[model samples]
Target: MLAVLQVILLVLDIVWWLVIVSAILSWLFAFNVVNARNPVVDSIGNFLYRATEPLYRPIRRVLPDLGGIDLSPLVVLLLIFFIQQVIVLYLIPAVYRAGV
Candidate 1:
């Protein structure tokens, strides 16, 4: 059970990084800093979009348009952080107590 919790924590950490990278890549694409015409760049962008878009779609619907700015990523990051904290501070301790 502890091992399973650890695996979940690790996966959450990895996804946190993915969110950051995806946001940066989106910004670069938006600002024309990266050329999406290149196959490599396009592929990476598509991958990030596919990974993140589903999560963002619901948040986007809830949030009113801010003229082109997107806040879903920030909201998602906050949610991920909150979940991580809950698992670390509450769930893991509960599991440890249960084992004893």
Candidate 2:
């Protein structure tokens, strides 16, 4: 059980980090802070989009737009938090403290 919680926490941590990185990269890409001509950088951007888009799409549809600035990621983050902190933690109370 301890190991399972650790693994879930580790996964959640990874997903959370990916969300941050994806957000930054997305901003940089959107605002042209980073050069997109580099194949590797472009690929990274593409990969991030692929990974994050599914989570964002439904939220995007439901949430009102912020003057064209999407707030779906915020919604998605909230959902993720609920899943990790509420759902997972509640489901595995014994493991939650150990994981944290």
| Runs off by more than 4 Å, candidate 2 | 87-89, 94-100
Candidate 2: the clashing residue pairs are none
C-alpha positional error of residue 49 in candidate 1 after TM-score superposition, expressed in Å: 0.4
For candidate 1, what is the lDDT? 0.92
Worst 10 residues of 2 by lDDT: 86-95
Candidate 1 stretches with Cα past 4 Å from truth are none
lDDT string for model 2 (1-100, tens) is 7567668778877777778889999888889999989899999988888988888888878887679687776777776787788646575775566664
Q: Residue 17 in candidate 2 has what lDDT?
A: 72
Residue-by-residue lDDT tens digits, candidate 1, 32-62: 9999999999999899889889889999999
The positional error of residue 32 in candidate 1, measured at the CA in angstroms, is 1.0
Q: Which model scores highest in TM-score?
A: 1
lDDT accuracy of residue 3 in candidate 1: 91
